[model samples]
Target: MLTQTINPTYFIIDFDSTFTKVEGLDELASIALAGHPDRVRIVDQIRDLTEKGMNGEMSFAEGLRRRIELLSANRQHIDILVDFLRTKISDSFQRNKQFLTEYADQIYIISSGFREFIVPIVTEMGVREDHVYANEFLFDNEGTIVGIDEANVLSTDGGKIKLLRTLNLSGDVYVIGDGYTDYELRESGLANRFYAFTENVQRQRVVQVADHVAASLDEFLFHNKINRSQSYPKSRIKVLLLENVHPVAVQAFEEEGFKVEFVKGALDEDELCERIKDVSIIGIRSKTQITRRVLENANKLMAIGAFCIGTNQIDLEAATERGVAVFNAPYSNTRSVVELAIGEMIMLIRNIVPKSNQMHQGVWDKSANGSFEVRGKKLGMIGYGNIGTQLSIVAEALGMEVYFYDVVDKLAIGNARKVRTLEELLQISDVISMHVDGRKENANLIGKREFDMMKDGVIFMNLARGHVVDIKALVEAVKSGKVAGAGVDVFPKEPKTNDEEFVSELRGLDNVILSPHIGGSTEEAQVNIGHFVPSKLLEYMNNGSTYASVNFPEVQLPKLGNSHRLLHIHANVPGVLAKLNSIFANNNINITGQYLKTNESIGYVIVDIAKNYSEEFIKELKEIDGTIRFRMLY
Candidate 1:
């Protein structure tokens, strides 16, 4: 078991919306005005007032005044509200009740809500009456009418700040609430930080100005390294690999204390879905697909490592929405693919394939009629990305003049020239090679029209996506003597296993060379991908760094020192920084370093703080609202 080290000295929590999912005053109004003629109107008014105050559009004092004036009942209504709130405790807070009970002495509920309802709900969670600071309700002799105790500091705006300042608490003060009033404690320098608690409601006004936003109480606890009981233990974290992802990846995961399961080949969609249900991480090559069904079933999946250059097999949009980070070795296997393209180019240009087949069939026609040297031949390339650029350099070394075209602008490498359009490369070059991606736009990119545009008897090759070329068009071109020969490593439909009988339209053609999609299958490339991808997955799992994740927000975290690291993931909105800083300042937890990164959807913050701290500080951090996920790295 890992030894616990954090200690939190104070826990200032809110009542309505923070601890419970609903506003106490609105609930009270419903019971107090039960069956009254104006009950619906009065309830609506109370709810609007509550939203106004929670969103910082109206002052807490005025909102509280209006809500109290609308309440028609007395002590009985308070008991009813308490009962409802007890049933409506925040899910995360309910799950961590034991942790809260263990530190009940440090937990304080400071709210503008009435003490009559607050006491019963908090006390049920083990909080003592004296620790709860709230407004008091005064009742008539008949207990039928009531008024607030105006003398109480909490009855006015900025009252929480005023009351906390007067107490002069010796330890750090962490404030957790979902309203502008809760933010006052931090703004006025009375508390170390203000956490915008948003488990129930996300008030932008409060979240934007908060020091930190905690989506759930458990998020805060997890960030402070206090409540990780529900997190997957390292030994139990499963990594599933398919399509023969290199053994190095399995070794790397095992070395990092993760349990790894390696399958020899790709699984069908149903098999993948069943296998992924218990996995925390998954590794795959190009064959296996991580569809929506796979992601939906992979409830525990945190990261995916694509052990190849292309991530077309993985459903990235779904992965991002599920908070599953995806990584790929975009450069690890470039050399292997380029070398294969170059070799295939040589064989096709010299018309070696047909002549070799003829010799094997006992045909003794040893004519060098169609054969030509690659020297001075124009080699055209489509999609000038990593592989294309490298192929161009090597082709240039072989005395081949290179011309390429790409959808995006790419600088020429060596003497390779970039053509203005695909048509220009097709018409001018003696040989055309494809290296495009698996994007839908590239489907049949080189079809009938493209074949017609090519110079007569031109050698052709496609080592990129299988669908990037029209195999039928290429076969017709070869049969008609329009294309000299072709080399195709990938096909639109491929056999599932190595031993399966291969099939293709170009199968019987003597001028064509077909391979089982081994462009990036070299041992060196596989090993490199194995080392690169698993290390990235391990980095994210161990440190919460998403530097090269293709899907998640990217953040390059620095090495940790003698301090604890706090990781906060939240909705990408305003005021999160202020809330986090307030928590640190309120607790006097000195931050040695901090790094933050964000995308349109989420914000990630990493803070390295002084090693000496209390568990109470962590609990307070968890109480901030709008936090999606949080972690503490030691």
Candidate 2:
């Protein structure tokens, strides 16, 4: 491990929007001026002033003076503000309390905000009284009105820099805050570097000039080589599962000592975005959409588990770019879907759907005219993947000749013939079934031209993606008797929830079987997916194994033996590996084992070293030029 010659002596932090999620004065105005005549006008003015001061458009002293004048608050309101700020602490900062307490002497809170609210909150973090450099308010005899202490150095525009300069700190100084005043500390050369803190608010002006940008306090601690395990335990990690992801998933996560919050149904974009802010992992079924906007707001999310076959509901590209791995149950539900396809094929070939519908309508025409046996009928399969290959073996056992067609060159199962073209399969087979993915190219894959190629008494079924088949074309083919019977488990336009009404073109057609997308909704499949996906998610989070990730570079690592593992994700570039090795060598740390994997966009490296490495080694590894994210797994 490596050691640093000069550790930071002072950690000057900002108070208002840096430590808390909301501006203290703005919140105070809302509470204090609740029933005032012009409460809206005053609250707007206070927010505008806060923005002006934080963006460097106006002096901080002027902004504070204007905000306090408009607040019209009393000493009683200060108590309310303190209690509110107590709840508004940054999530990541609160999670790393031990780090703050361990470095309390080196950390300093210098802000233009009043001491009334700052003291109670900072003290909870184990910060000493002398370490808090803030302005104090003067209260009257009745505790009804307050005035600021003009003599305090923090009341000025560039007060942070001026106060830090007077302290004459011995070692390197690092400034972490959200506003212009915090940036001034590094601009004036009093601090070594300025980190633009954006866990609560992100000011473009400050971020543009910052030497580094940190999303949360965890980012700062990780970069500084501070072990977060000292503060936040793995048990505190939060996992959210929506769309009724099976209870097995909740059990798996809870068994591993994680806090799991299970929601019964899907959430809209706005609701999901708000709920996902502090969640570390999310489990979703087909109904829940993990869009790009959701991924952008989920700063704390480390991984996602798609508890079904397809990951089309999630933005895998965006998740990978943000260092969030995406895992799916690609093989877990294969058996259920194959069984459903086989059952539907038998029902369609025997004309059971029309006969069932006729019986319900009180028609007694039970003559076996169109109904046929499945003894020697030819069956056609498309997309010979997991479900297709498995279905081939079962169809052959049912005394059906299987003819398969796939874009890829797949090996044929027993007695199953591979056709040269989809048209060739359509010409000879008596029944056709589709099982394709959700790729854009698969939309309308079976259209009018291909439907015209089928025989007059052929049966058709689609249990795959809804958009893969042309519903209008299928309707016309059924009406014209070109296709004798059809069974469809999926539709292009489906109701969002089970309570909603379902509308389809083939609703009242005889000999047509329409199901509500139950191909993979069996109890056995859901339970298997629940167990399978959560295990992959936990494996990636705890061991840094991306073996089944749909988006990230794939790497399966063994558990470190009495060693510490460092996971480094970086842009794919030259010399990054050499730079990482050099950092370890310079610190005299011996590497036990290392694994590296890369794609066109990113490079993932897992380094295992003896347990005696110094914190300086972590700091040096983070300093590498191309580092995107770094985590220590012990």
Candidate 3:
């Protein structure tokens, strides 16, 4: 933390779109016009008016009058709107409620919105009701909102400026809002600074003229050295996404206020080591290898997101040892991989590849000598995981008999039957596809011996890991006519990038399909993996929720409430939890909620406690024995 330097005597904050996440009158219109046929259009019109007033596109008083006339709201609607607005507080302000309580006297709720809705929300945040300043609403005998009180200066243009001048606040007053009028206070030299608050919304015209742009209240507080809920601002967390991960992942990271550095291609080990030193979170697909050396250099790495299904390119043991949580889209791309297998099966059985090639060479070979239909054929699946099960259903839909064999017993899907052994499936299968993972023992799982076990002219496909299949043995099988046609998506020594050349012995084989490891490269699959993997990484980073983490103890978490949350990752050994509990007891720390989960090698603990602690307490926790990584979030 930096030393306190920039201090202001007063903080003037806006109500709608700054303190809260939505415009006040627009929400009122939405509630008042519920079930009305014109609700959407009227609500949208109110929102447009709100935008116009904020941007100075129209007179503030005119916009306010038009919006109030459009809303047929009463006191009952206002009560419901207040309740909804309480839950719709901007995330940054909600997290920094402690700061608001501590400095309530210095903070003023200044806005062009009404005091009726603003007072209830700001008072709950510990702001004094007398300190709140805004426009007043007039209600008739029936408790229906008629219009704003015209006697108030806030009901006219230049309202915020006029209100600030009449109050004549002393010392340096800072303004924080999302509207052009908020900038007018600083422009008129009545305030020290104006921050275009954009946690809820960003008006570019206002942002362009402001002294600074604050993405969140935490950012503004951090820069000014005000005591905030979080020890470090989320803006400081740097995320490095490599290997052209989908843009959806980038958008997710940016939305969390984390600094994102995107690399279109994979980096080598040396390059990655240099770049990983300051990266808090890293995302990658295959091709980028995360070795032990790289993890050692990743001093600040909290989590790793594998945007693909397999994590073979990452060093899971090294990551676990360093207390780095690793996550992957385990089942997000399952459908895409299964669809590719089905497509390849049809193409291979129908001899589509050789026929296409022959046509491209200006030779018309229309004879159906070796072609066969996939219907009524036996389809064998080597693994019974997510991809295998989905493939079984699709293959059965094509009138094919489905057979599968896995080391772990799995329930059959649809008409698929589980064979006793790999040899049994291979002997009985007319078309075989591999879907196993990339475990060490699964290397060369299919070689000469396995190929010899299959019946003559068997159709083979391997969309699994490259090392699982012996390419040389597969080539010999194809040459000797033992295998009719084959589809190989992965290769043992594939090129690192699309620009690099792909060298394979199976390239020129007749009726063979050799793809560049694209079994799950469909657009739909990438988009799904893109959303799934980053969500896991962000959840782990934000709330200590390690659900579905590939290498860490799984502990799903709820949203953090009024207390502080502490996350501790340590070696899974005896006495660690006791030591943690003892430290908490000795330091007089009150634990509100506690959770602990452990794998064979690592233990994860989440504790929500009273938000009072000294630096010495933090130091003690960090120095605890077997502790790997520790973080505090609010």
Candidate 4:
């Protein structure tokens, strides 16, 4: 959508630390020699040798010999290691399980790691046997001793190219992963693009050589700028851009290697509900509403982006209750908001709005009494979240006394007060600022009653929620001089999208600062917002992290215990969870660590098992009375 360029492409990803969380060979070292302190030194050496081999600092044969001598590893370690690698699939890779199955022909595994461990891991990633190419290990009759097959090309120079020749792959080859071996796939001209996928960990050497360095998988899809590969129709993921997104935001997804379809015009709730049929990722700005119907009809919908601040437009409770994670920009526009608040305070206190209005009307209304300096003023803050808290420091540095009121206890960053109630702060402050955010209960936090409680000649400013202050009541207060001046930045009837017509009721008012919701609209803010929000979303997509997420459980998905598993995303209604347990019970599936995480609309339940189960039945369980999306990835 950002660039009118689309192409067909195929990706050959690497294993080890790339597809899985840990390096396969290193994992083999750990599980095999758990209590042996001596092997730890060997692991460090093997790691260094492997790095050298990839970087061409040492020959592949030389590196392998050094590593083999260091470990003296046996067949027993590999047996345990195979079980460990089975559980380390990356989030971005795991989410694209359908793609792996569908694009089996185009997807290949090219790694310096052993085929013994890598093959089994990729199989769990939905990759078949014939598609995987790696080094092989030789086990003796006793099965305690081991040796690697020197016959394989991976044991020597230009090894990956030889393996590729055997496959005879067609289409633009994209090599994505970390490590020097992965980089060599490009250096030898075996791949068209060497994408340095640093989503997990970054390497300077890999980054320096990569045609492109993707911080996340979504970024990889966007930069590649390819939508669908003709080679893989059934498997090609169709990304739908619902509502309009920033040109840069669209580019970010395209580079990550997906085919994106963006519809620019605004749509009603019913229209959006109808449009999400085939979209894998539906990206929208603040306008498009992602309702329950839209979610239910989004048969292919994977993720949703609010694309702007405050996800009030979408039903978040419904989203969380339905097992959907909604992403938004939290601190992307922090500085812009603080500056706007300071400017509004100055404008309201100095009577700039009235002066400007009179000048525009061609009248010389240069009255001096109303206009005053903002030097010695007491500015009371209503909330102390990011924006409010930032404004506090800015206000205090400008010789203004700042008093803050927050229901949830917030530590005052600068010298600000934790007032017991709104009344206590209102009685003393000269300029009362309303910086409270959007919570359901804050519909009319500031009204005639609260305004009447303020100092008789105090000015007021609201740079936060539109509905926080009753606009009509404030307008009446300003008109009657009950409040000396008012600066209103937002309104309850604001436009949903950039294409809509915005109308305000407080038009043509004197001594009242009216900003068209420009509290967070600086170029710096916009640019940072464009990059930061998508980055965090991609981080969550690649790793199951919820750092800046507005709606969803915020916790790190720690290492998985010894087990194959079931991951279910379902609607958070009654009996659905019980039904899932009943199905497991009927199947006699022993469960471990069944983590249940929810926001408001959806529930994400991760199930681990000690035994193997048929994954094909997962599709059937999806139809289970109230089942949403049941995924059994082992």
Candidate 5:
């Protein structure tokens, strides 16, 4: 109905790799020639020809002839191809089904692909059968071998231009496709505009000559001021990826049509607050802090992606209280951290640092007095979490006896023994490796009192939160020989960037491995984190799924189907659900499904309805008591 408000015009669309997610001929070859020895080579040739034709490198007719000669397809194979293509429709096209159905009369699908395939797919999408112009497949009597009808204009190089000229009553015609043929309509003065559709595939030559390149059909419709299923265009959703998030994450966001602003380094509180106000999503690593003040300025913020193992750098409470979902890579870098801990434990226990340092100073002290193998030594783990439990298993594999202590009851792995208290593990073990979280209460968890309880000359390490251990206490204990060589990866106060000077009291200490918080800084770890955290943020943003959110209630949702979904985040007070249902009932809106999840402070409700609602209904939902945030997703 909204299409009625816009200027009337003809919409020319492509079929394969434009209307669908894959090339029809390419997929047809695979299905038709299944179990055939030449299937792969023939399919590759078909795809190559498709690319050549789309890029305008070869004649369209020649490409089509070569592809048809290669595909051993029949009438039955065509039917199977049709079924497969029904599932491969472009994501943007799938979402805008209503727009297609409502404006069926103005739309035309002109593709070089066969009419047998295009008609079944587009007509199902509500386009009139007569509006579909494509090559016809001419089959033999046995229905085994086939060729395209050469007389059809679509079988030629300038087919689209020739066809548009014949149907010349069009007013302000628009061509949308991934091929150069589509742009030919515009170049020949038949079309007013040519949108290079890149939702499924992109050809550079086609892209360069296009009047406008659209990432999706949604984008094209949005550009034309046509109503669509999405509440707002993805291009308008500003994503701010700070602290040099991996390029994989940047590419993922950009592919989804987000306007990404990537900053290579961390921003301070005031700087972040100013930049975050208009950002819908913000991605950060460990250095940048998302404080309550920073969150207060994030008016449009929907999700926060912490591209590291720790969420301590973010204000989870403030993020959740503001109805923002926070996602982090909790187990992505688990192996990296555990490996670092194991490496450090071996180096410190064997006195490798002091020996190596002595050699560097030309002392040549090779005495094996304090040097000892890690074999049979008691290894004490302070936290039995992902990293902690992994370290326990690995240390046990290295022939070290593992002893772990955690406030929460964690099942011991391998021959690892669990202690009820940290003091019990510290008093008995030979090496203490801290692998805890960064909670406020965990600050100074290992102070003078805990250090004094450890055995004399005990090897120690802290690869967990820097604030958990009192650095000054560790320095004094190391000097007094109460604690032997220590490996300290994280620190209480670290410089923002690598260029700044690193000043620490333990800087001059001997036999100490002081790393700059790179326990999980491996390339493998960064890549894993990059892929993981962005996916979680994207899922939360696109589907309202908070499966692994640190603070919000976890809800894993299926892919949204033929329905409009509404996400309502409100204070965890009674009667909110009843009130929401009452509004829907009063409006005669039918609820398809409703999901509710709650945390201590807030409740998250996801409601699915069969049809679109009025703007007044949105206002009613927002005006509901205790409502924190409301968003519509399609």
Candidate 6:
């Protein structure tokens, strides 16, 4: 066996409020209270409850129960809430989504959340659903709130610490987040680095635990391994970064001797195909689509990165077939999003949008008639995954009660009760928000019938998918007074250019809030995306690693101590292995240990031969037929 040398580095991430823009549970509350006047109070309570639990003042189970009982919510509100929550993902996380896809097998989410949300979101990020290890929630035969998977690491105290030790990672470990639970990774010596992300709200306990503190993700990356690494040996690595990826991520790649290229917005399939021909690394956010055609044209691509939380943009099967590795910064921008959702929920609950518009328009219409408090309100959730569960805690702090619903049952979080159906959540909530996944079936999820289910004069918001709601129908609903007000962060057809003219069906409407889909566009979030994405991309290119990869078959090759490593990518056929063995035999090469792994179409073989093998030996192997490609990696 080749002696194992120290590998460069590794990362451990928290799922809920790290990479995504909003706390998943907070979005659930937003959905739950869609049209209710009590929305703001519920959010505050959840937040406070979470803080109390993290500080070791209360049991997680008890804290959760207290918050849920306060909410007094049900199923109807959850359906609409699911879509809103789903849309609150961060741009940074979306941009680096490829890192997880390309390296699907290596990246993991050790969240204290439900699989109902994490599974869908992680799968979209190109991570195998099975790779996600988190708490599971179950429902009864009649679809009522039930028990949780007590054995899950997330449900257990210091569970992430235990899980990391079991991994026995060959490389160094790093952790990033804004919560006390995330800080535990460092306290337990499971992580070599702990980055405190402050783009969202920063906790004193979490800050104290972090080894490195960053205001923006960009600043953090600048101080880390990105630009300060070794010099390039070849023509600089060509990099393409989409808008969602922070410039810092590109800078990090450049630090590793790469030539970084930037694009400020989304790209169509054809455009991506055209731009990726000479690129070694491709990084994008949620809006940039990397289809099968894009993968086929990536002749020089060593890795693809989605700098955001999701990798649904890229065609994973296509990238795998072509052996293109993908990566993403799963936890890099989560706090930013969660923070935003919390802030938005407060803003909406206090009737801040209408007042803000009045102030901006120089009206100064300080009317107390419509303004209200979030305290004592019921908050509902649709997908009680990472952001959802975290939001549940934050909401409790804001003095709000919380309830959640998932198509596939999930664990109760922070006293948040689980509801039976989406319809029940809608009927009970005063404010309804969405936090569902971007599945094909999720298209047009909120239509005329669904909107008609909510309480009249309720606040409605969607931070989730542009495709989930029928935009025109939403406009109609708002106009007809079915919804009291709306805060929409995403639109069905947004302009590609930032300076382009924007027109919307809801324009000229009063008491309606419209955002530029910047829920997680904080400076802190950009910096994290910048810092995390390039590191993942560089790791894949410099070493054939699948950590944080979303595409290609997951493979983590052992570090070869003696250097002469042969990489073979061949068609998966019966004779290929025999032919490779014969080539080694005829050349008098004494192979150390060879690893063979095959997928449906290709077989990847790594052989460690003597460092001083003759040039003729390589030539002989090159002459073998059926070898798709053969070369020395290092």
Q: TM-score, each model?
A: 0.62, 0.64, 0.75, 0.58, 0.75, 0.58
lDDT of 5: 0.89
User: Who wins the lDDT comparison?
Assistant: 3
Per-residue lDDT for 211-266 in model 4, tens only?
A: 98865555565565433112122124556665555667667666554557878755
RMSD of 6: 24.6
Between candidates 5 and 6, the lDDT winner: 5
Root-mean-square deviation of every model: 20.5, 11.9, 5.9, 14.4, 5.8, 24.6
All models: lDDT?
A: 0.83, 0.85, 0.90, 0.72, 0.89, 0.69
The residue pairs found clashing in candidate 3 are none
| Predicted structure 1: lDDT | 0.83
- Kindly list the per-residue Cα lDDT of model 3 for residues 352-412, writing each as its tens digit: 9989998999999889888999999999999999999999999999999999999998999
- Candidates by lDDT, descending order: 3, 5, 2, 1, 4, 6
Each prediction's number of clashing residue pairs:
33, 1, 0, 28, 0, 147
Q: How big is the positional error of residue 600 in model 4, measured in Å on the Cα after superposition? A: 8.6
- Descending-TM-score candidate ranking: 5, 3, 2, 1, 6, 4
Tens digit of lDDT per residue, candidate 5, span 148-176?
Answer: 88899989879888988998744678899
Q: In angstroms, give how far residue 393 of model 2 lies from its true place.
A: 0.3
Which window of 10 residues has the lowest lDDT sum in candidate 2? Answer: 1-10
Candidate 6: where are CA atoms >4 Å away? Answer: 1-232, 360-366, 556-560, 567-607, 614-631
Q: Model 3 lDDT vs. the true structure?
A: 0.90
- Superpose all Cα atoms of candidate 4 onto the true structure and report the RMSD in Å to 1 decimal: 14.4
